[model samples]
Target: MGTLGVLGLELVQMDTPPTTAYLQIYTEERCKANCLFCAQAKDSRAGLTHIARGMYIPADLDAVVSRLKMAYEKGYLRRACIQTALYDKWWEDTVYLIKSIREKSDIPVSLSVFPLGDERYEELCRLGVNEIVIPLDACTPGLFDKIKGKSAGGPYAWERHLDGIKRAARFFESVGTHLIIGLGETDEDAVKIIDELHGYNVNTALFSYTYVPGAQLVLETNKEESIRHYRTVQMARYLILEGIVAYLDMRFTDGALCDFGAQRDVILRLIEDGTAFQTSGCPECNRPMANETFSMMYNFPRKLNDKEIASVKKELGLG
Candidate 1:
């Protein structure tokens, strides 16, 4: 039996149900990369069952695929996302699994894995994969090195990941990247990276840094701080991605974002629309409570109403 996300299990059991379903498979082998925030890290106490703040229960691959196919046929499963841990032969194994799923179901697949070169990209394209996500989890190179690079004794290099993102953008129409907030980076750092990735026509998936129970990183930020920082970054990301603002025009005060380079009215109008606060991930995927509690959500899986919009504005200091 392979591990499945909470949503995946819900789909299989037909619980409250989600519009989209994630197969949410992970590589069981121990990861070579020792990312400090990751539960799969070599030194982390978390095992294969714990990932991304959710518990993954064991289930058979074929049975999971069957359930996914059934859900798709019923119009409940819109996409399948496969997350991979860095391990020896992981690439080959992931490729095989992708092919297996494609053969059984027609659900569009999104793969979140380590940066692979052009040959592998072409192979995935040939296999009918929808998109590729290479997570440059840290916003700045300094932070990256400290948590996921040489300083952390990890295998990932900042330069190499950037190159891979560029390459993937050239190959896939819907290429994407992942960034984790609260990793010792400021709002400016996060927005700058988002603006840079926008240049390549690449989209980004934002995740808040949630401390896993057995992971090394301590969960220290309070609710108000986490909400404020995340809301600011999300607004900045949306503005940059939509081409409504540029990083050069943005003003920062001591590494904190102070101005979005747009007029006050324009910014307020955008904030009121509330699309900026929704979850950011693969196309058609809205992962509710993926990184925060339901009461204090970092990203809303659904559209925000008036009250919710007001709360988001308050958190962003716009109210």
Candidate 2:
């Protein structure tokens, strides 16, 4: 029963059987940002326990490497990801850990660190890191501040995160971002952000906001928010990457998605490909059990079965 840390939440062993895919490891100590929604926020005394929700204590560097080696040898884990927080001195430790992991593990490694500069980005790329995740939680800066209020760095500026993503895309082979739903943003805004990310060839992983038990900010997330965001993101992904439609071609009127600007058949065809299903992002980064089970599953985290895809297509009205 190895302990896995996320933000400030520590997870026990898996409640369900472990799948033979990617293994998520908490590779850092505390986070530097106090995103209001985060359970790891310094002032947040939330009793949340989720693997992807927050940062964890940085395990010994050598031991993390050893554990990964042993896990890989036993065929328990395939790809490994190191999810880090934005600690004050976090970058040095993270840089070292990334280098160390590259030296030991033959498996591809991905990182979820803060928005670092071009130099560090290039350094990691040179050291053989394949993917990096920068989580821009809200659609806009004001929303970002409201959602990630009064933190140490105040709130993450949306433009800065975008700039980071742009820089990263130029350097790294795979650049990704995380967008959380239920933050009062409309589905159109969510889609726009996804389109914007696609412009940089940056992949996005979608999340639904799950309230921590004792977090400072007490916002309630609706289950419908997750469903709508998932459906819209799936659509946005196909539209952007497949070049089915442009963001300007879509419009939101009175809270309804309008102006798809493409033929009904074309849109349906793309949607039918199951690319519009919940499994979006880099190769093999499906994080099942990544979010709260009680809420709507934000990302399917795996390939959707036929019935599930049909259900999503029907729900999205992609006929």
Candidate 3:
């Protein structure tokens, strides 16, 4: 629905509009896979239009595609990101949407989906999808099994997801994945997976596990703990990706990151820049409030003010 407003398809107001046009395929059928955290999961009782606080209402495809062309040309949006749900004809709808956008404009396109075959990956590349994201969602295999794999009655397997990312990397220049924090993952666990995915040339985007009323999964957690874990992984990920430190160089105690191994001045410099805190994903994609509330923001959609930066430092125990 936010994308609708940005495209002028819906009357809405947003303090920080999304830079990428987030389009989800419309279908009454729920996903075949039963991922517990997903509102669109087969067994989930949550509304189908809900995806972590973002309401994606059904809209006319041609209308959205046409407006998307105008929005891109005017620079209100940078990329067209197509999110998919696992249902019959998903591939067909996804292909049609991508082709529709490509025929109208030269805008950069991104596709976020589950694992696919080599032919499909190549097809996505041909369709002008510059970036492909296959979300792992969990920090480790055990957590994955519990949340979205066989244990949760979902079709996804951790090894296959990792394998899918590797396969997709061959077809697309930019391959990325997602990891949801506060799903009972330790700081060290999050950073370690980021390091591993880095070896595969994959960029890992971070999300805080959000609780929706009708979704099956539930956990008791505090805000302070959640932010602390996110901040640590974010900083550690930056240091590792920047080549300032490696996961092996970092110190961990009881599965928590005890030290980042980078010097105080280097860490301070990164914090001041604030790129480490923004939404980490496809280029030019800043998901404003995608996984946050007004009082707490996991990913600052834009540059950080001095006060927010100070809050970040405090979250990392540096303030």
Candidate 4:
């Protein structure tokens, strides 16, 4: 089969627009895992962006960087981030490519590489990388394996990913992970995971699960469930960051987020604290159009406008 080519343009919002840059390119190879919910998983061979949520369409690496360079030189985007997929240990080329861009460009570079050990991470840091994102796609071991099927040796070790994040955070000013919703994980599960990451001083970017064709788990998820998950995660982040609530005090009933050990009004205040607007992945990394659709935003490219914040709050009955 022929290789997939670069796709279309997407307009996005940023907490502070004209400051952060985003670009997502194809991995150029299929992922080795058999993650049931993903399109790029083994045997699927579907489009690249289809495999993961919150990633933009593929683009010619050089062209995208060229445009970003111009933007940075003109003071449009001060920082740029490059995120890629990992089928295994075959991402050396990707690292090299990002390193090359970092060398020639004045903008800060961030990478969301796989859980390669400290050796590769240390190398990237030396190469002028400002941040790294290790997406611990699942919170628990069983869920990790159930969704992200084992290959080579096995799916990512939960403890190991945490250890890696903790270690990376200590050295880097900004370190992050991506957590997708609707993975059969409870709202509580998602909240607790982000809470725990915050405890370790690791930042989290939350994503609502996106379904595509040819996946084993093709069942439709309740829209309310997805919205609820996003709101809870967004709120949990605010609470934790504001020191209003602890992870242990958060409560859930039957997979729904029930309480954050705070008054209702306090939770609302936290949501509006712009804590939700804090960039999730990497320092100065704002991925506009990262999730494909503007309305179905995985991350708010810009700070939430009055309309958006009010709309989301109303949907969750928080308004």
Candidate topping TM-score = 3
Backbone clash pairs for candidate 3 read none
Q: For candidate 1, what is the lDDT?
A: 0.81
Candidates arranged by TM-score, highest first: 3, 1, 4, 2
Which tens-of-lDDT digit does each residue in 1-319 have in candidate 2? Answer: 2223311123555544222233333423444567776766655675333334532344455766766666666655566666655656566767677777767777677787668889889888887888888888787666776766443355467677778888888888889988777778877777788788788888877776766666656666555545755676567666776787877888778655765667777766665666566555566555556564734555565556677666676667663
Q: Model 2, which residues run further than 4 Å from truth?
A: 1-30, 47-64, 70-76, 149-155, 265-272, 292-295
Q: Assess every candidate by TM-score.
A: 0.93, 0.80, 0.99, 0.81
Tens digits of per-residue lDDT for model 4, 155-208: 556677778888787667878888776778887787778788887777787666
Residues 78-128 of candidate 1: C-alpha lDDT, one tens digit per residue: 888888777777777787778888888888989888788899899899898
Evaluate all candidate structures by whole-model CA lDDT and list the values in order. Answer: 0.81, 0.65, 0.91, 0.66
The local distance difference test score of model 4 is 0.66
Summed over model 1, clashes come to: 0
User: lDDT tens string, model 3, 1-319?
Assistant: 7789999989988989999999989799999998888889999999999988778899998999999999999999999889999999999989999999999999999899999999999998988999999999999999999999999999999999999999998999999998988899888889999999999889999888998879999888898988998999999988877778989999999998888998888888899999999998888888887888889999998999999999999999888
What is model 1's C-alpha RMSD? Answer: 2.5
TM-score of 2: 0.80
Cand. 3 TM to true fold: 0.99
RMSD of each: 2.5, 4.4, 0.8, 4.5
What residue pairs are clashing in model 4? Answer: 13-301, 13-302, 14-301, 14-302, 14-303, 15-302, 15-303, 54-290
lDDT of 3 at 187: 87
